[model samples]
Target: MEDQVELKRVFGDVYFRARRDQNTSIVYAHWYGSQAVETVKAGGYKFLEMIKEKPYRKLLNSNEHVIGSWDLALEWAQNEWAPQMRKAGLRYLAYVVPTTIYASMTMEMLIQRIDDEFEIRNKEADAEAWLLR
Candidate 1:
């Protein structure tokens, strides 16, 4: 949520910026624009890379500006990303669910596949609170 970005992933004009919240020691990412299967995979890689750099147990993933469903990436996200998050010592995830129906559904699918402590919130503030708590 701060301007202290550590890394960024760009797909066209969309920007996925990640930073470590010094206040809470949580790695968080916020992005804008639409998502496809490829973008989802790429974002997953970027998230993993960021989290793996530190022993961060919590993540705040925001999809508030994301415009499309990432349903096509569900298989890879479930089979690969989920397991890797656990391997990287990630224990808690606070996902800010998008407002769109399909995008929210996609988030639900991904959340259900995760085998760790996680929460989905409609607002970033709520997500951050849950992550910090």
Candidate 2:
């Protein structure tokens, strides 16, 4: 019998369970839970491999911003995952969670980082219209 995978929601993100179809030699990430954050932080090389093992894609459907521990998340996403995905021809839309000035280095640094990595958009209307454009 073929194995079946399930999707779970955690902390507002949907994740998939990890599954392998031996006949097709394909691996799938079919589970998403709160543990995903930790899993990613703990060097989820297997997960990265799984994403590369097959044709996979992602669509960002939210406007949420990264809040607490934004730096850690940024470090992981940029230094670890983005390059691999780009090489694999995979695309992603991330709702970059916004952080307050106190939590981040500076407005210039944040903008430069986001511009260099991801497609960023403003979640709210305000004075910083230039940033979104």
Q: In the order shown, what is each candidate's alpha-carbon RMSD?
A: 3.4, 9.3
**Highest lDDT scorer:** 1
Task: Output the worst ten-in-a-row residue range by lDDT, candidate 2.
Answer: 59-68
Model 1 poorest 10 in a row by lDDT = 1-10
The whole-model lDDT of each prediction reads: 0.74, 0.41
In the range 34-96, model 1's lDDT, one tens digit per residue, is 777777777788778767777688888888777878788889988898788778878788888
TM-score of each: 0.82, 0.39
List where candidate 1 sits over 4 angstroms from the true fold.
Answer: 1-12, 115-125
Q: Which candidate is the best by TM-score?
A: 1
Candidate 2 lDDT: 0.41
Candidate 1 is scored at a TM of 0.82
lDDT of 1: 0.74
Tens-digit per-residue lDDT, 1-133, candidate 2: 1243334344545444445445533333422222335544443454456556654443221212223333445565666666665566444322323344433342234445545544444343431232222
Residue 110 in model 2: lDDT:
42
